[model samples]
Target: MIEILNPAKLAQARVTGALVADILQALKSRATVGTNLLDIDRWTQTMIADAGAESCYVDYAPSFGSGPFGHYVCTAVNDAVLHGLPYDYALADGDLLTLDLAVSQGGVAADSAISFVVGESPAPESLALIDATQRALRAGIAAAGPGARTGDLSYAIGSVLSEAGYPINTEFGGHGIGSTMHQDPHISNTGRPGRGYKLRPGLLLALEPWVMEDTDELVTDADGWTLRSATGCRTAHSEHTIAITEDGAEILTLPTQDR
Candidate 1:
């Protein structure tokens, strides 16, 4: 479903976005060496509850996933990428962790993700991979505007990943989000420009550009939710929920400090 937010609804969406961004930033700060994945999930639950918000993930039962995702947030470490289910694991130094979160506040939902190294150990390759995804996400957001087609955003994102030498996977990409966690107008990471759905004011889209270091293929972990690189290479993912407006695309998921 394609949802267009009215002015009042958009205002509520802004609040939802801000809350999501703040929570993500908080989680990033708290995640460190020895941080347990379950603990991270607990932290997320507490934050959501304290804010009087609802987790989009907790009881989410999408077709691709195993069942109801009984977690508060997605904790993707190293090879794990999308739909990462939190489990019993302690973070180690230099662990490439991706925290993807979505929350509903005031009846609106916003989704975002961030990738970072766990501790003091900085791996050049890991940093580069994460940086590439971030750069691609920026490119995608910049391409989003009134009248811009989904392909334009995809092309911009794909160019960055391709130039950076990372393989793209289209099976799972960004999508429309608002009033619900996922919606129509699928945004692929790679595509031809001037095609697909046309942008319009008040439309919300979650543009995520993710890539695996070596292969375009993915393998589902035994848990049936975590998606990993088929080649076991490191991966990175970046995402943001954006609203198409008259002036341009307003990135709702940017941190409060950045606002």
Candidate 2:
């Protein structure tokens, strides 16, 4: 379903987005060498509870994933990219970690993701992968505004990832997000401009750019949730929940200074 938030709903979305961003940032800070993936999930749960919010993932039963995610956050490491279910493994130095989170507060929801290197001595390739996704995310956000086509954002994002020499997988991409975690108007990572859904004020979209180092193919882990690169190469993902407005797109997931 596609939801166009009213002013009050949009305000609530901003709050939920900030909370999601803060929780992700906190998890990143706590994820170090030897830190267990399950610990990250626990931290996310605590943060969400303390904020009096609900986790969009805990009871999530999307068809592509195993029923009921049963976790508070997605902890993707190394080759893992999307739908990364938290496991018993501990993070090692130089591991690339991606945390994707979504939460609801005051009846509104927001989603965001961030990929970063854990511990010291991050590989140059890992750093490059993260940078490419980040740049692509920025480009996608820049292309979103009133009357803009979803394809415009996709083209802008794809150009950056392609120029960075990374292949994008359209199997999973961005989408409309609001009262629920996911919604309509699927936003692909790459597409032709001036095509697809037209943007309108009050529309919320989660634009994510993710890429594997060498292949666009993905393999599901035995756990049935974690998606990894076919070649076992490193990967990265970046995302933000944006609201299309008269002026432009507002990044609701940006970290607040005080938080």
Candidate 2 C-alpha lDDT tens digits along 114-153: 9999999899999999999999999999999999999999
User: In candidate 1, how many Å is residue 48 off?
Assistant: 0.2
Off by over 4 Å in 1: none
TM-score of each: 0.99, 0.99
Over 19-39, each residue of candidate 1 has an lDDT whose tens digit, in order, gives 999999999999989999999
Q: lDDT of model 1 at residue 65? A: 89
Error of 1 at 28 (Å): 0.7
- What lDDT, from 0 to 1, does candidate 1 have? 0.94
Residue 16 displacement (Å), model 2: 0.4
